[model samples]
Target: MSARFGRLRRVLAVLLTAVACQSPPAVRAAAPPGPAARASGVVTWAASADRMGEGTAGQGYRLVVHTSVGGSDLRVRFTNAFGDRPLTLDGVYAGLRARGAALRPGSNRPLTFGGARTVTVPAGAVAWSDPLPGRIPAGTDLVVSLHTPDAAGPATGHWMAMQTSYTGRGGHTAEESGANWTQTTGSWWYIDSVAVRPSRAARGAVVALGDSITDGWHSTTDLDRRWPDYLARRLHAAGAPVQGVADEGISGNQVLADGAGQAALHRLDRDVLSQPGVRTVFLFEGVNDIKAHTGVTAAELVDGYREIARRAHAAGVCVVAATVAPFKGWPEWDPAAEAVRQEVNRFLRGSPDFDAVTDFDRVLRSPYDPERILPFFDGGDHLHPDDKGMQAMADAVDLDSLDCAR
Candidate 1:
């Protein structure tokens, strides 16, 4: 019995020793929720993507975009979302914009993908360039130059950039001189979003998700007079923490249905939540849905809004609902649409789903006729606001409301 007990103790000792000598299995840390999970960088500027005309081979495009927040490690996102075939970009460059397609000398830097200068975005996919080692300032007219060696399918781009861009015949993207980039275009091609690493760790971004008005339809081109632009300047001047701004508005976008681009609900993940460091979504849409008269009811639109708020909340993002602006003079304005708009605005004003509300209808409505937009703010179309109106809309928003606890 003593011998058996001693053998058992020796076996147990051997087991313990073997366990101590062996390594434990590797464990992966849990991924944090939401866009910060990617943590590549924060979005400084962005434009919504839609189906544009067919892409041209050997076409070099010089896209002029405005940045909202200053940061280093600048990166650009290219989309082939609407393409049926692979889109290959052989040369891509980023630089500070001087006059008319001209890049500031020595500021033009070539961008690479996974260490290669060329990248082929798969059909229905998007790719982001490796970070460029540099810092860009807020409100910089950043230029992205790219040459597509064989891009043939339907192109993906923003039609109403509200800023002028240029196109050259061949791979002239490396040239800083504007002489090679003679042709002018009003749209931005290929690229959809630009991101940068902010100096402050807590810095976040806000995305304006809406329609043509938010797309800067009536605002002066090249001036960056859109309401969101004004808001960006305000955030910068005040030294707000949420400094980045992305305009994800399409001209004919709706809340419930697909038309101009994917409906706000469908594209919410890609355009809003997926954006890095997006703290809030300033939802100013639903005007197109009401005006289109597709038999969409107020209840349906309200449901859409509620879903948006819920999804955003689940992703740790705050939602600021904006009342739909009055448009009594626009051709689509009728008693039925006006009724829906009024009901939606009522819901937006009091809904707990949103973190805060901005009464744009109250700000833009004419005192003499509550249903009509204020003439001073009207862009003559009665639906969209003029530059002054845009400024007023931006001013009405409480900057503090945008920076909320999520």
Candidate 2:
């Protein structure tokens, strides 16, 4: 009995010694949740495959948010605030490339929605990233592979602002969704919300809303010289990460009635009020109404603008009204149209309804002749400002009103 007991003790001792001497098995943990962590020295911008800015037809595309400020226990967000149909995801994976080859040995992971592996966002909705493991540090180029589950239609992209990260500000409720009737009707529609990220010391965003001018009609492509782009560039240059800009312009949009887009009132609640981090709203419109919708008189257009300002102010947004520019030689230009344009300009120059004003007309109209666009600034249409003309329009904005840091 004593011999047996000694042998049993020896075997137990051997097993314990081996366990202590040998290396332990590696352990992995569930990723934790927290605020967006900073991935230092990173510049994150949104983009899809195939086109630098435009997504392709039929084939699915992924918009990558490059993170310069990376940190641990991190997660990501995907968007479809501009999609027309339900965006179904096939599989989501993360990857890092070295000289166009996979850098991180295991760069793929299944993405989940509402904490599950797959998600479907209805038109105008966005989905967020589940907590991903480990850390995505500075200089890490992470790509999310998104597959569209169905055949898609002709796509249009929001072209004005050069955005950094494409953020998901959650879904638009029925009340919010109902405001954009043009989107619901579906002739052609774009984004509905102002995407902004949470920044240190309380982040805020400025919303720029208007028609083609705000859409940057004649501005050179990839130059990113849109007024809002200039504004954001100025802000960022000034180290004003606290404030961002959201360009909500839709080509052919008007203040009083529907045209290429729903009337300004039809979109105000969603584009202006429901926007995330929107601290200020720059309402630059009325040219289209003056040129195309002649049924509404100058007085009516002025009052309509006043109502827009009223609505914005009621919602606590600082409103800046822009004076209409000279459109005397546009193909659609007529003496009656010019009169309405002049009358509308008169209201903007001296309107007490807005919190402040920007004289875009003063900047683009030739010094020698106030009614005619400077020969250099005309896009030959007479109505739309050329590149220089657009820049002049941007310069007309009251930088102080923007209160942007840079």
TM-score of each prediction? 0.90, 0.64
Cα deviation at 147, candidate 1, in Å, is: 0.4
Clashing pairs in 2: 38-69, 39-68, 39-69, 39-70, 40-69, 42-68, 44-66, 238-406
In model 1, what lDDT does residue 379 have? 81
Question: How many steric overlaps are in each model, in order?
Answer: 0, 8
Error of 1 at 285 (Å): 0.6
Q: Report the C-alpha lDDT of model 2 over 19-120, residue by residue, as the tens digit.
A: 422332121111211123212211122211000122333233322322323334344444444455665555555544332212345655655655776676
Q: lDDT tens string, model 1, 1-406? A: 2557534543553354234223221211111123432337678899987777688998999999999999999989888877878899987999999888898889999999999999998777778888899899889999999999988968988877878799999989999999999887878999888999987833899999998889987787788999999999999898898999999988778889776677788788878887877999999999888987789999999999999999999989999999999999888899999999999988888889999999999999999999999999998889889999999999999999998987
Please give the RMSD of candidate 1 to the true structure: 20.4
RMSD to true structure for each model, in Å? 20.4, 22.0
